[model samples]
Target: MKKTITATLILISSCLLAQPVPDSPAYEHELQIGLAGVSSQSIYLGGKSQNRIFPAIDYQYKRFYFQAGDIGFNLIDSKDWEIDFGMGVNLVGDTDRGDSRLLKDLPNLSLPVSGFISAQYKSKMGLFKVKHDYEINNKHNGNSSSISYAAPIFKGQWLIMPKISYEHHSQEVVNYFYGVNTVDATLSLPAYQTGAVNNIQLSVLGLREINEKWSFVGNIQNEFYGDEISNSPIVEDDQRLSVFAGFLYKFF
Candidate 1:
């Protein structure tokens, strides 16, 4: 169940804006409970495709919010611009179970908790956002940054959003997660050093409102990795694809 929850959370964080946010005054403090499913390709060598189903929860209370397993607070709330700070789990280390037989002897990587600051701008063209996260759990002691743009389209009771983003992971993060250090080196896996990794992702998010109390949400995304990560000893693919779908019920 840990793996399923981790996968669901990863998808939620990657498609942060994909989840439907009700604008009604009645939903000011909403509790959303749902069941979600994820199908994704792994980058690790010998890693098979992962498909899992899991339950999800989200809640919003004024400036404080909890989405999936992430807890955050809005430090600045405004009409055109907003800034927030909070802590959440990183996507990589947590989900990597080293499922490959080749990686059976590797040291287990623990999930890293990170503190993040995010800034967002809403304009006629689209919604633009920039966010930075630094590991605070003394895991990799690394940091990452991402910038994205999303445009929302409304058609009747359905809302669609297309998004594009670029994310950069610090060298420490790449090395810790993908690099084959002396301690992890095996006869079959040679020691490998890594640098900063960058990724480009495209996503489409959709929501269909069933009623004031219920909605259907879904997202599809493709992420392409940079050479830094793809060239790692344990990595086999340069890209990953993920899909998610769920239903959320709003409770006041």
Candidate 2:
């Protein structure tokens, strides 16, 4: 997945040097570098949120688009509807801090990437989007789906979007991250398997344009875990919250 995504990125960058027809829309691009943090309330592995500064790329040329850490290409584009193919990264960071004994002895899981197909529609109410993804690394081999809404405000320069999404974890994924195998099961933590909806998240995204070349972005989200996830002996929290704020420089 990483290789395919990287190659696609290179191909998109090459488009920046291409010469479009006289009437083709001008190229649009943005680059951002800033700090981000996510504070998790999960009790599993005593995990804590992290803060890090990183660079982001937002590039759009005709039907192709890349934003933040995800990249997508439009398969269908029209006045009020669009279909896109996208890919994103999944992180299993900071699994060494929790107090759960069932989790303490477990090995840490590595990161995996996902690829998705999404469809979007715009109406008077707002813009609605839904997507389905699969883990491309075969590590977790998990599958997930999500639906979100976006409402642009202030002539579309500023925006507010509220979204809800649900994620299903494969038995393998749950076992690796939340399961207690027979060999490792103890009196307090028995062997268990999880293979259903494990996470549901609600979030709002806000963006404001400072000028033609500068803008600000912010988002806050709350995630609620399902019984399968919350019931794990390694887990401590039924819910968690995360936030991000950043700025960007746009070009044309």
Candidate 1 on 89-158: residue-level lDDT in tens? 8765424543677676777777788899999887888789999999999989999999999998888988
lDDT of 1 at 40: 78
Highest-TM-score candidate: 1
lDDT scores for all predictions?
0.79, 0.58
- Pairs that collide, model 1: none
Q: How well does model 2 score by local distance difference test?
A: 0.58
Indicate the residue-level lDDT of 165 in model 1.
94
User: Model 2, which residues run further than 4 Å from truth?
Assistant: 1-40, 43-45, 90-104, 155-157
TM-score of each candidate structure, all chains considered together: 0.93, 0.76
